[model samples]
Target chain A: MLILTCPYCGVDCDETELGAGGEAHLKRHGPGSTDEEFESYIFQRENPRGVHFERWRHAMGCGKWFHAARDTATLEVFGTYVAQAFEPPQEIKDKITAKRPGWTWRDVA
Target chain B: MSDVVTALDGATFNGTIAVEDAGLTGMITLRGDFASTSFQNAVTGVSGVNFPGKGEVNSVGDRGLAWMSPDELLMIVPYDQTNAALAEITENLGEEHHLAVNVSDARAVFRLRGNGNVIREVLAKLTPADLRVAALPTGRVRRTRLSQVPAAFWFSAEDEATLICFRSVAEYVFGLLRQSAAEGSEIGYF
Candidate 1:
């Protein structure tokens, strides 16, 4: 029942109209990487109880893929952004820090 | 070539609201940079309407321009003139990196009429979209699920809405709409 706005179509789509794409910002370690690196890349993912970033597709709407940052614990959405972006925008990161108070994800705070 | 027949062969059902297969509608799926002047010009040249804002559908007669996404627009034209209109835009676009394909045959269009804004109630039964007049008034199009199928609809008038879905599921959508609009099914939430 979570309403997440699609960055592409600008529709506030609920969970039913969207398809979840697991964790976001995955970096693939290819053939040249060590076994552990490949294993971590293929299997490891952050499951923090607080703020998290994830991918969602507007399956019933514009058929576009986008990303959303939300709190896992409170279910409050921080923001949504385009999938093509490599990382969260400065403003969204700032918003996350402002509300969560000392919250940091990877090297991005 | 052959005489064109819509998916439901112009089926009509008179429930709480009038549901009818709108026969054949020419739809062109055009994908390109909406910011491109060339794209804008070619679209307006054929559809005779300005680029609509996000979620807006600017339609006149058989020609309409609807914002389907950030980089995509759905052009509605007369069924008989789909090829010509597609050709016109493709030629006008020239070397622009774009895609203009005829989707007329792949989709079914439905018209829901009557009951004085109760049409919104009928549609609300099928979709999760906020069907309140303020949320989905005339000129605004919503792409969402009609129960289990993906459908897009817009209000052409306060008492009427036009719905479009894949041709393969035309019958399913029609059944869903007909049932939603069945007598005594009216739920005045709009």
Candidate 2:
């Protein structure tokens, strides 16, 4: 069972205690955006085999949603941050870079 | 007039473990900034127990507070004293960004006690939390699922725990507990 520490409640919640909220930090493309942009925003997802950012809610624990940076293949979570964050924190990026050198997620290099 | 009865009102079971309804305890879900001095003072005034930190439980006499989350606490008091406690908390908090909800009827509580290893064995099957004394200890509260159902539990003593779950699934939770306890007896768990 994967355990992720909830930043709000300080509990290392088992996966059973959490609910996956899909990709994190997606900029919503609404009415003003073109059809392609809207489609990408709603339907497109990066199911990369390496580093990925996702949203998770501590459903059974704190009931707060948070973000996690993890390796999709290994399921090794690099870090977890509060949901209010717009992007993965630099320290988390640095940690991921240190482990998997030359890895880049989206525009955060 | 219709009489209201709890899910476990007439239910009784005997085995190596003992389980019983806590019986209409007053429960309030309080949400606010835990670091706020006013919030702390208000809660202490009402519950007589200081506000607990994350995963902690504090009690003074029968009134108690269990930290449900970073900004949430579950207040437990005698069923008859719920209104008084609620009023005291609401009055003292003043205008803080806070919420006080009477959730007494939304939950069902069960007290469990047994000899060595019995409680541990039963809970181990249901939760991933480490039930050992070194990890959980007394006064540690855990908000986690018991099997597939969401529940909150705390160690009241080394050999005792209090389990609270939504009233809707109280019977199912009780059934699971009874089955586990009975199975433990068969295997000489304690």
Task: Encode model 2's per-residue lDDT on B20-75: one tens digit a residue.
Answer: 88777899999999889999999988888877877899976679999998889999
Listed per model in order, the count of residue pairs whose N, CA or C atoms clash below 3 Å is 0, 0
All models: lDDT?
Answer: 0.89, 0.86
Candidate 2 local lDDT, residue B173: 94
Model 1 lDDT tens row, B61-133: 7789888888888999999899999999989999999999999999999998996578888887878888877
| Candidate 1 residue B141 C-alpha distance from true site, Å | 1.1
Cα lDDT over the full model 2: 0.86
| Alpha-carbon deviation at B65 in model 1, angstroms | 1.1
Report the error of model 2 at residue B125, Å: 0.5
Q: In candidate 2, which residue ranges exceed 4 Å CA deviation?
A: B1-4, B183-190
**What does fnat come to for each candidate?**
0.61, 0.73
lDDT of 1 by residue, A32-56 (tens): 9999999989888888999999999
- Every model's DockQ: 0.75, 0.71
